[model samples]
Target: MQLSFETDVEAFRAEFAAFLDEHLPRGAESLERPRSTAHIPEWARRWQRLLFDEGWLLPGNPPEFGGRDASLLQQYVHLEELARRRIYHSFNPQGLGIIAASLLSFGTEEQKHRWAVPVLRAEKTAALGMSEPGAGSDLASLRTRAVLEGDRFRVNGQKVWTSGAHDADFILTFVRTDPDAPKHKGISVLIIPTDTPGVTRRPFGSLIGPADLDFNEVFFENAEVPAENLVGELNQGWTVANGSLGHERTLLWLGFAERLEDLTQDFRPDGVLGRDRYATLVMDLQALRLMGSAALARAARGEQDVAALSVLKLFGSEAVQSATEAALETAGPDALAHPARTAPFNPMTLEDFYAGWFERYARSFSGTIAGGASEIQRTIIAERVLGLPRG
Candidate 1:
């Protein structure tokens, strides 16, 4: 768990810190507030470009792809700097961090130049199309179909809980390309243009903060994409998914752990966080950090433990939920009020990040739900990490 960066990383941090001071726009500091779904204000996109121009987007990619092909420590320092400044890592974090990572790992050379570069440049955004209305935890049951026809594939079905679908330029869609084969074997991933004909997205209603249009149910009615858009080998999507999933889970869990620590800082149990509970939550945050660091260390050595991600995912999410619960209990009567109003009344609140504490608290549950559910993660732990027999 030693995060001691190489000498080059130390220099990189000092340089990045200076850049943040000079380039960060006013009022944009510390936007990593919990349950805050606010994204892509024109200002943010402009800021994203500033980072892009400075070669700060992806340190692991080749220089041509807005990266420096930096060392492992340099990459770690890159993310740490962003978190320290509380800046959004990208205009499209999913695109830059998750989907782009996958494309870099599994995509053809042409795909990387065509898709990943635009994503890093912030000229386009991408959303992962994996979960379905009926096949969430049971992804093998997903029924979305994409039949190959000459140089194109005709896609049909629906994707639910699709984040940024309405705004993304395209989707890295997983569809059934061989129904006659086993469910898992039949699946394939495609890069489908969001604007393709017969593709439609409708926003879902929300009690959470920010725009409702960020999360949508996307329907593909015989949507079509060039056959060359296929990502990875056909029927090999399940393997392709692991590349992005592992990288994202590593970074995301670290973020959640860090945010939980930030939220509960200066926590007095006699106040919003009960004394014993606050102590325990703080310790849990520490444990989550160590786990995250361990995962990062492993990744630095080029060893990704699927089981470790499951453990981090489960624990990291549950830790947030616990912190949120403590915050709510600490707020007492004020917790029932709207987040905007509660901010003014709660003496414990110091930063604007707490303005929507309640909503953020409520939204904490999505951590366990999204990516993969707690139950599913536990199963991964049992079957893969621990070598336990399934029921």
Candidate 2:
């Protein structure tokens, strides 16, 4: 697809560059990766608050919701600039991008005002409680139970891989509201305050040290949530959950793809791989970008091509992984001295950008795992896009 932008977008890009230059927080001079930013860095949080105040945070949103109502292409350019510069902008990905964006489409005015807007401005933070110990890829099988009593729902269950529950103001939890109904149909979503009486959190430990408890295990011991906290119709959380994941899968990788391309350009591969490996990496990166841009353009036009998105996710993620592997090969024995894992909440350092090679590589796994696992994405492409029958 031929992608073109108006002159105004150029103006917007210039403004964004100026603002980013002027507003970036201290200690933000390094080249950042997607995992380093899964949880927004401290300086980035400062930057986002500024963006929110200036009505540039969510570019496509309206003024009241802290957006510029910018076009998709404008937002695309905005994101591209961020990726190019390795700047992080979100406070929490689930709150600011996925849940709140989904709320714009599926929530009531009150819900939007109470939760979504604060989330946009970073005044309030939220986490998604979707995956359970036994329910990673099969999210609908979650066994968390919620029983309505009077005007509140008493929630009782555990959520694993629930990122940021330790610090999030609220958890957008999925619970079984009606056990007798079909597993998917009986499910419902609730915005439960993390400080609720019966709620508790345990941070997952890093095998090395200082893990991003951003990925957490939360327990609700009959925790109470107001009926008003329920988002969307009861027993219709599958739809709401899908809406959130749609935003995540579609937008989260834009920065990653852009960064991969950038890194490839800067990469000085030598030894066994050399230019042959570098050339192939560049070609793969460009192909991934083309598919991603086309899918994003279609999304901008209110179109959904499940297969196209699946292709973007699958190829984009693998391309990044491959690129990282190439970078690692170049790093050679130096990789042995580098950190093995990237913490979910900390910012990356550019001083020795390649010094922490494995972290970036290991971090790429989340991109494939979250929203939807790469395996599931391939299945979606096969069944929905290629017109294959379910096995």
The sequence of per-residue lDDT tens digits that candidate 1 reaches over residues 229-319 is: 9999989887887666766766677677767767666465565677888888878888987887788788888995778888988998988
- The per-model lDDT (C-alpha) reads 0.77, 0.76
Query: Worst lDDT window (10 residues) for model 2?
Result: 344-353
What CA RMSD would candidate 1 show?
3.9
Off by over 4 Å in 2: 1-3, 27-45, 207-212, 269-272, 329-332, 339-355
Per-residue lDDT of model 2, residues 1-391, tens digit only: 4666678988998998898788766544423433321345444555677788897787888988878889877888888887777655674877887878888878889999988887887777788889999888998888999999999999999999887777788888899999999877899999888889999988675423475345788999979889988889989999998888877776666755775766665565654347888888778877877777778778888897777877878877777787777766777876556653443323432323334656666666776777788999889988988889998
Q: After superposition, how far is residue 95 of candidate 1 from its true place, in Å?
A: 1.3
User: Model 1, stretches more than 4 Å misplaced?
Assistant: 1-6, 27-39, 209-211, 338-354
Clashing residue pairs, candidate 2?
Answer: 163-214, 164-214
| Stretch of 10 with least lDDT, candidate 1 | 342-351
